[model samples]
Target: MSQITISNAKKIYHDTPVIENLNVTIPDGTLFTLLGPSGCGKTTLLRMIAGFNSIEGGDFFFGENRINQMEPSKRNIGMVFQNYAIFPHLTVKENVAFGLKQRKLSKQELEERVDKYLKLMQIDQFRDRKPENLSGGQQQRVALARALAISPDVLLMDEPLSNLDAKLRIDMRQAIKEIQKEVGITTVYVTHDQEEAMAISDQIAVMYLGEIQQIGKPKELYHRPSNEFVATFIGRTNMIPAQLLHKDGQAYIRLSDGHMIAYPALNHLEDQDVRISVRPEEFVRSVDGPIQATIKDSTYLGLNTEYIVETGFAGRIQVTEESTLDEDFGPGDIIRLEINAQKMNVFSADGKVNLLEVI
Candidate 1:
């Protein structure tokens, strides 16, 4: 296991900046995810760490060693790509032993390492099968085994499970998580899938347009987002235009709907146009509340029913409730909506100030 530190790293593509003055520290033995939409430089950043791409500016280091000048093979990093990248003609055992062969290991040592990783990944039974004869999940396991057989200090995965079916992806995610924990290798995984990142990462960095918007644990990013982009991108949220009414000693700000919402104040300014971000699961359907809304639509998502409520004061608010949310409100049903004041977040119109910062 090793710690990775990137300081003021920048990258460019044809005069266009891909990463801008980026700085991030991935803790040793932790699974850190770089998450964002496509063209956000996540893959570019991963390539930089893997030594597949050059560092245009700043420094990249693994522990105390400066690795920017190192070759990809010398970086001691295992990479699992989106494509399985398995040899069609080679059996699983041969594929896993490829790296060991590169090091010129003796036959006995090669066989020992190959058998170890195959059993570790639970694909030993497929040792004699070629890539064409294995399932997608089995193929992914073989690819992982091949990467691990190299015994790299850090593992880099670039959307390794993107090619699998949803169910297989889930199973593979669990398998990967277990393997990572068992081996205790520091891992850097890049993916556009928010759920996958949230599921396995010890820390997640939300990137946008070559810049990191926020980096924190999944729950922190979800519950207390630093900006509108992080709040909207991390999970489902109802962003409503609101006016800063006033503040108390506790930094409680009133909204345009004449409701006082208590939250951590980010700035000292009294009056400003603020956008309040409330998660869909934070609203409660009520008979009498500060605001009245009409149910515009409802969606049953098995575990929960999502309500699109059109408020007279606040546009459309998405309210998510468990299937047992007591009462059901169909379309056109006039209902009172209750917002959880403590659980809501407020940000500037540009979505910079975290409401938690003010109070």
Candidate 2:
């Protein structure tokens, strides 16, 4: 019942507009993430949704109730901040029970609710301990437990896992996905980490320069980004300058390396300058491939090997492939490569529009 709908949202800071004419809807009981770089206004939009920031000119609603002017406390939202904002002075049980007690729940109800969430978040063993005594992961669990103990319609998390260690961050992200599914609360999460957003989000809204650039599932964003910014921002991609040519009623792209490849989809467009977005994995190291390059260096990670290669026409570009026991191409080793045109993206010269139709 907590499907969030935003319409023509606007936010301004000191007469400078931070967000303008934004519209998005978050489905009920789904984990929606706002993802972008630090200064892209993801946090600003999140604050607007939580009723902490005044909406300059827009309608914000949870379900059918307009909450644009409502008090933050009255909006029935549970927010877990980046700092793990649990009280250091209070024990875990008291911290979990704090929100319930604010609603004037009876003693038995508050105690049961506290125990339930403490058990749900698996932090019951630390019930009698204060925040200062808990590790970062444990403290984060306490914060999540306290937030859920209130049984709010919506949960807002702003970089909740950023403080945990690398391993704990992975563990906690899985825990959050499971817990969110169990509770079925409509949650809006905000983070700058693309991998974290891909791991946990049901749908992600990628923002930039005070505007939402794209919104889609993780795979959709990765495979079929709407523009140059979205394609580059969501994952690692090499932008290669290329030329679009139509010959014999067929479409072909001449890459910077002077290697031309046919892409049937581009036949409709006129011959012009274009940019090709190639992910590292899209490059195949074929013995007879057209493009020739010399490897400048190689980093052999366990699963894959990444190479920085210098090409005659394309300058230096990155390529990734699976590590093989017998193949070890070192610095100065020449290799031939080809792009997987079926999977590659072609964009306008200005990088504003992706030429390939969404499949």
Candidate 3:
């Protein structure tokens, strides 16, 4: 296993910049994910790390060795593509032994290693089945087994779960996590699904427009986003415009409904307009509070009921409450919303800086 590091990584295509001045560190034996929307440069970055794409300027290293000039075959990396590229003509055992053939291992050793990975991936029962006869999930398992049979120092996956069904995707992601843990391989995964990345990654780098917006743990990015983009992208949040007020030594936010909510006093935002981000589950239903709204819509989702409440001060905000609540809210029902100041994230009006840090 090795820690992959990229310093000042740059990629340009047809005179247009894709990735510029990129730098990140992937620790040894951890699963890191590059997450973003389509065309966000995530796949490009993954290809760069795999030595499939040209790195115009920067350094790529695996542990202590610089691999910028290294050939893809010499990188000793295993890749799992989105399509699970297993040969249709080859059986599961043969597919898994493909990489071992290149190494010229003894016949007994090759069979042993192939058998080991097939069992590890739990596809030993289907070892004789061809890719055409197996299910999507089974084919994916074959691909995974084949990749691991090589004992790669780094495993790179490019949306490996995209082709599977929703339920299978969940199951495969769990399996992938367990297998990565068992093998202790440094893995870099790329995906556009936020929940998938959160469920499987040790660390996630949120990319946008060829640049990293933020890099942190899933919960850290979800709970305390660095900027508005991170706040809205990582999860659902309501961004409300408010004015920062300072009375005596205390700082408060004044809503448009003539209600003031107390907040931590920060010297930088004494009397300036700001935006407040509150998660759907963070808003509490109350009889009396600084926020008042009318239910515009409600969705029953078994575990929790989602409410779209329209407030005079905050426009429309989503609130999620447990379905166990005795009182059920419906459309056009007048309701009061209350938010905990500590749980709320305040950002500058332009949505660039997080004011919560100053507080």
Candidate 4:
């Protein structure tokens, strides 16, 4: 496995900057996902790493070697696209063996590698079938097997599971993670799906407008987001505006609806405007809670109950309840809401993480 480094990279197209001074270091043998919405330059950054786009500044290196000017084929990178990109006329065995054949390996070596990867991908039984004969999931596996068969130093996947059905996508994520762990290949995955990135990534970089907003482990980013954008983008969050209320050295913010919430004083913003980010799961149903709300609506999901509560202080808050037990809420039901301020993330008015002040 090889570590991929991109330092101060810039990409411009038609005089428009797509990515600006981007810096990311993907650890060796880890799944690093670049996650963002459409037109946010996640795919552009991936293409640059794969040598499909030119970088105007900074350096890109695979291990110790500078690959900023290297050809795509010379980068020793394996790429899997959203579409399977399999040769329709070729059999599965030939598709997987194409890279080896290009390098002119002997017949016995080719057969050994093809057989090994086909079995590894669990598609050995369909080795002789054409692309049309295989299901979408099977074709995706074939694409992955072909990419892995070449023993690439780094693997780049651009939403490889986007085309699969929901069930297949979930199943394939497990398979991909296992295969990546077993092969120990450094991988850079680009996708906009938050759950997908959270599920499979060892680390995630949330980007927006060609700039990286935050980069960290899944739990770190989810639990303690660096900014409002990261908090709102990575998952569902209820952003409530609050005023910095001074207290015993620590900062306390009163919600707009008149509920006061205390925060750690480590981020010492005094008498400044701030906001509190609370996840849906952080709220509870309680009679003596600090906040009051009426259940505007509740959706019954199989595993959880999602409540849209109209809070007097914050407009609306989404609360998720585990469906393992019976729910006591429905539409238009008045309820008292509880907030766990300890688990809240505080952000400044300008959207940056409020780490300098205690809340």
lDDT of 1 at 316: 77
Which candidate wins on TM-score? 2
> lDDT per residue, candidate 4, 50-136, as tens digits?
999988888999999999989999988888999989999999998999998988889999999999999989999999999999999
lDDT of 1 by residue, 120-145 (tens): 99999999999999999999999999
Extract clashing residue pairs from model 3.
none
After superposition, which runs of candidate 3 have C-alpha atoms over 4 Å from their true positions? 265-268
Global CA lDDT computed for model 2: 0.92
Residue 209 displacement in candidate 4 (angstroms): 0.7
Model 2 lDDT per residue over 1-359, tens place: 39999999999999999899999999999999999999999999889988889899999999999999899999999999999988989999999988998999999888889989999999989999989899999999999998999999999999999988899999999999999999999999999999999999999999999999889999999998889999899889999889999889999999765678999987888899988899999989998988888999999999999999988766778999999999999999999998888889999999888888634
Give model 3's TM-score versus the native structure.
Answer: 0.97
Number of the top candidate by lDDT? 2
Candidate with better TM-score, 1 vs 4:
4
Q: For residues 51-159, what per-residue lDDT tens digits would candidate 3 score against the true structure?
A: 9999999999999999999999999999999999988899999999999999999999999999999999999999898889999999999999999999999999999
Clashes of 2: 0
Location of the lowest summed lDDT over 10 successive residues in candidate 4: 261-270
Worst window of 10 by summed lDDT in candidate 1: 245-254
TM-score of each: 0.95, 0.98, 0.97, 0.96
